[model samples]
Target: MISLKSPRNSAQSNVSPPVKLLGSALIALTVFMLLAPLVAVIPLSFSSEKWFTYPMPGFSLRWYESLFASDQWRGAIANSFIVGTAVTIIATPLGTMAALAISRPETKGRNLLLLLFLSPMVVPVVVTALGFYLFFARFGLANSYTGLIIAHTVIAAPFVVITMLAAFSRFDFRLMRAAASLGASKMTAFRIVMMPLILPSLMASAILAFITSFDEVVIAIFIAGPDQRTIPRQMFTGMREEISPTIIAASVVVIAVVFALMATAELLRRRAAAGLKG
Candidate 1:
């Protein structure tokens, strides 16, 4: 039989058993801590009892049924998708442009501009939400779908900017010159030579933008009208007005969907990175 162990693996195997056990235990503990609340809520969502309780009397899909069949829940979900998609569409291109501008060697104050672009992620949500409320109210934009979409775009754009910045950092800009020398126009070069190389990162950034918009409730609370309530806003209202297990069911579903999106985004990011290495 061939020896399969690499030097790195053999060195790792030389670590003390106690150290490995301790490391494994810590990781398990951390995972448990992070997942405990979500796991607890999931079971309650499935409880047959109308009220939240431990050791549920039975199992039922009543909450899940309410989530899908009810008009309010269904409307809120539709609104969330609409706003999230709009935010993604607006943020992705704008963010990619911003990243391109900042990545140029001739661009001055790149660090300062990058900081301003990413300020949304560092600022308090309430402060940002309040600012949106005040600014949009002046134009009668608050509580409208347009206002919600704009507010979400502001929040979501930062993630795209961050993702695209990293992508641009790994990108080779000389390809533009190469294409231009081959009788290609700037737009043609970007469309044919540059965009394909950066496409995976673009997709990953778009996914992140959508997820950011979908999960945001603070901006929605301040800017969204009664007719523009998204899932997060609806879930918040449910928690405040009625602690229905339906909210829990909605949350579980949202979590699952977000996790899937995040997983796909990570996969795309890795593929982009692999392409760069290759």
Candidate 2:
């Protein structure tokens, strides 16, 4: 018996070792660049020194303890959760509905509508924050939770819309029609037939929207009053007014939360893909 290798395989095998090593080196460099700041910040959060300095004299949990003990930090954390929850609640449904509508073959001006939905993502945050500040002020929403929620929703909704759009791209509309033929109402059909298929995507979008609102700072600064200060806004103020290890601790907590959310989203995404395949 004679063994023969395909030309394509032979060509690929002929690639130089230096090229593979170069590609690996580039990838490692990119990962290091992205993670270097996080690496620095996490250790600094545990440092005992009042100021942010290298070669720490000791490590202590005082900053983390202070974060929990301080009224300002507690209030900011509460406000962040409140606003993030509000934004997710509002944005998720609206985004899913918009995606469903746009996914329909007969929907008119779909491109225009999609562009409008995604405009917030393209526009500069400072510009959007300034606009929200002026608009909310006139409506007596400024310096209120309502104002922050609305502003965050405006920005966060685009993430949900984009995510749902991708999910809807793979959705089978025929199942929805099948449910309708069985005497199900539109809402009932969606809940029973469509929702299960897209639920993971919806959950992921909500998480992303929540993170967007939670981490948002420019809009929070523009619209949030002292009483409505969010964690990011509070951190900004602390950084400007005074330097403390507490901000470092807060950064570590935030980074941890973000990593957890991202991991959850990735799991949901994998499960969604597996479900679709099955």
Question: Could you tell me the lDDT of residue 256 within candidate 1?
Answer: 89
Q: Which portions of model 2 show Cα errors greater than 4 Å?
A: 1-21
Best-fitting candidate, measured by lDDT? 1
Once model 2 is optimally superposed onto the true structure by TM-score, how far is the C-alpha of residue 7 displaced, in angstroms? Answer: 17
RMSD (CA, angstroms), candidate 1: 3.7
Task: Indicate which candidate wins on TM-score.
Answer: 2
Tens-digit lDDT track of model 2 for 1-278: 86598888888799899997998999999999999998887898888888778888898999999999999999999999999999999999998888877888899998888898999999999999999999888989999999899889989988989888888888778888899999999999988888898889889999999999999999999999999999999999999999898998887888888889989988887777666666
Q: Write the per-residue lDDT of candidate 1 for residues 158-267, one digit (tens) a residue.
A: 89988998988888888899999999999999999888888999999999999999999999989988899889999999999988999999999899889999999999
- What TM-score, computed on C-alpha atoms, does each candidate reach? 0.91, 0.91
The global Cα lDDT (0 to 1) of model 1 is: 0.92
Relative to the unseen true structure, what is the C-alpha lDDT of residue 79 in candidate 1, on a scale of 0 to 100?
94
Instruction: For candidate 1, give the lDDT of residue 232.
Output: 91
